[model samples]
Target: MNARAEAFTRCGSAITTNALTKTFHGHTVLQPTHLEIASGEILVLLGPSGCGKTTLLRLIAGLEQPDGPNMIRFDGEDVSALPIEKRNVGMVFQSYALFPNMTVAENVGYGLKVKGIRRKQRESETKRLLALVGLEDYADRRITTVSGGQRQRTALARALAIKPRVLLLDEPLAALDAVLRERLRVEIGLLLREFGITAVYVTHDQAEAMAIGDRIAVMQRGRIEQIGAPKAIYHRPANDFVADFVGTMNRLEGRVSDGILAVDAEHTQARLRVGGGDRSAVVCFRPEVARLTAGPGAIRARVIATTFFGATQRLVAEVAPGRQLQLDLASSLHFAPGQIVAFDADPQAIIEFEKDA
Candidate 1:
């Protein structure tokens, strides 16, 4: 258990949303949805802007009331009528929201001080939190003097100082540069897990979501399209939107007759033995599944371009005019524009969606 866990007498609380929903201007922004977050689990809501992810988080934080009463619960206790303060939930946002006049230690202990915590107790708790976030050395530093990453850490420490039942973060790293955002995301995930806090994180970055979330909930246009572990959500998307949103997916269209699907274009040569009967087929696969081969293979494409990644290169291949597929291969290999290449897709990796899909 964390040292602070003993002080709070509890670490996390299970969150349950029973048909939770939201609306704005007579139109529903968040569709009726049910969600469950396990105690001590980190759940990330991921999607593009205006996807209702933040709306969902606010509802749980008591910042927004759901469409119905008793729709949100914490550890099986109804907190619908409770205000944000009464709910005992801590929030961190992109702006950091620290006081410029106050020192790091004073800002962190501000909440405790407001709640009438004695000076000795508040200072001791603040000291421990600063240590947890690696900001103990900067305790006396003014908030305005710290770097972006340091400021973010101070905000996190401030939120945790209250010993709230649940932690809510809204794009907390969005204000940082790409490199700092990447580094602090891992550090933040480790800190939350070490403290064993049930946390709800909101972000549009897939890599961040994958690294921090125990489970990712992909939302689209006010509804959750898919919810599962990071691997499952990426590998087995519930629909086309989910597949495209999560990662780069190569789609091939062909005709299937007697279990064999052959691409119709004359420039393309792809024949895969599949399960469907005679009909048009749409198959999808990831870029990393393609293997370059010199011998005859199921796929033949004209290499349009190649981008050298550190360990692997991503090649854009045209199986048909204006239809390009991305293939990830070893970085050592070289390909020229308009060069014809043959590669085979892993049989198990190919996925056939419905006809209307």
Candidate 2:
């Protein structure tokens, strides 16, 4: 086996968190959380800033202490008291933490050097890691001379040098530009799959979470609101918060009557099939599910803006006096400002939540 594959064989471990809680000073930042991650699974902790995703990651990495002991485990071994350096966990951060004075190879081998590994073995491992990351030719280049993406790859390689049992990444792509971030997201996902190591990735970007995570844990306030695969989280949200947070959700305010819900817009009315006993309801659907049609019972709207996105075109139309609805259509379809259009959402695509929900 190659050095990288050999290293990975000794690495991947399942992780479990039991009642993991974190409190700062006098305030509790993370509520008691229990999670189990299978070996070689990529679980993403997704939430906004200050929502405790980072706190949970730090706790797993041993950078932050939990409220009590027996709270964290790796492959059934309790490691609550272990420190960050002793946890044997790899970490990659948003800031490329590369030493400016070191070359790419030097940076990749720093962890092994600190462990007092033999110079020859360290060089061999570093060479293997560089090749795995597709930076074999740039090993001797100075850290300052490499591009942002290269620096990220170096950081990843360094983290893997120790053959860590678990990997913790905290917003690792937030600092990169949009294009670079997209490109590196795919690369990182592939690398994680190839290594088959348990990883806990933290990110506030929903798209990034969907792209890389095998399963996602969506956090809110101090607790996880939902945990599921990308498709489940996107299509079958646990609550309104989850539905609104994962993607663009279009809402129609209406009242249910006679087995049908009628949405009264400024100029037209939209009907939806919903179950409720003549009560107020808010129907929600994604932008991609809303379609423009000329049939009756469609909501009348005036196109206000259109944006071309190569594969698809997005249209923002005023459905009410001050409210707008957004929909994505085929790029070949033409839409112009001030043009009146009628649109309807499929019954199967509409999700009905209580007006106050």
Candidate 3:
């Protein structure tokens, strides 16, 4: 590896934020928060609009000042007062942000050139980075001449050329089509890990978060609702919001009796076996937990619709008069609307939350 390329693979920065916050006028957009990002780890901030994910990312980048002082540190060094450039943080936005007038190599090496690196060294480094991003053959191609995925790679190459201590990406794949975005996200995840840079990604897409993040922080309102690994967050959500946001959860709201929840207690239909003792409770489980069964005692539902998902099929079934549940079955069988079906849920798959949550 070239000296320049080798430098990027060195240990990335470890980040810490203490009581970090941001407020505008009289409203606080980001409440007091604390975060720890391990060296070379990728942490994703996942949430919907106005969830403060972007606000938190910007604060870490030094693009926006934190509401409090001594709140951010890089490898234990206070860097809250540093500006974006001085902080040595690389940023990739949704837009490619490549220089349309310049060739791909020129755009990737622009940062090194601005740092006063000599032409010979800059060209060598640019060549390496272009090849690193698999665009070696398109060094002289203009940004407008390449594919969207290539342009995205160019933007990333440009960011990494400076060997920044950290990388911040905000919805970098938001501009691409669904199919292309899906394909590129895997490529991007591999690229980021190859560089071993501490990265903070902000995105509202759950699938994107699951694919890219080593740990995902699900933000809500002005604070982080939960942070954990992708499977941990999905299978064991911290609360109702996290459960509902991370994926499709089938929730049954009714009274539990004798470790069972029956939507229609008298008919014994639509049961989600649970352990609430005996009280009004909401039983939550993933769509994959329920499976088709044949028995008079099994939970019964009337299929409202079915959506085929290639390897699996999702059924929207009406459990009660106004209650519906989504079940995913690994079956090629077909069921028409209004067809009565019996199913059973794994009791271990049940996720319970406090009523207030």
TM-score, every prediction = 0.95, 0.94, 0.95
> What is candidate 1's TM-score against the reference?
0.95
| Runs with alpha carbons beyond 4 Å of true place in candidate 3 | 1-6, 265-268, 295-297
lDDT of 1: 0.88
- Per-residue accuracy of model 2 over 12-53 as CA lDDT, tens digit each: 899999999999997889999999999989999999898999
Stretches of candidate 2 exceeding 4 Å from the true structure: 1-6, 275-278
Candidate 3 C-alpha lDDT tens digits along 1-357: 345446776657999999998998979999999999999999999999999999999999999999877999999999999999799988898897888899999999999999999999999999998888899999998888999999999999999989899999999999999999999989999888888889999999999999999999999998999999999999999998999999999876777888878676323466666765888887788999897877544678888889999999999887676678899997678888988878888888889876664
Clashes of 3: 0
Worst 10 residues of 1 by lDDT: 2-11
lDDT by residue for model 1 (1-357), tens = 656556544658899999888989899999999999998899999999999999999999999988889999999999987889899898998798899999999999999999999999999999998988889999999899999999999999899888889999999999999999999989998887787889999999998999999999999999999999999998898888888988899888778887777886546567665665798978888999988776554678899999999999999988788989999999999899989888877777877777674
Of 2 and 3, the candidate ranking higher by TM-score = 3
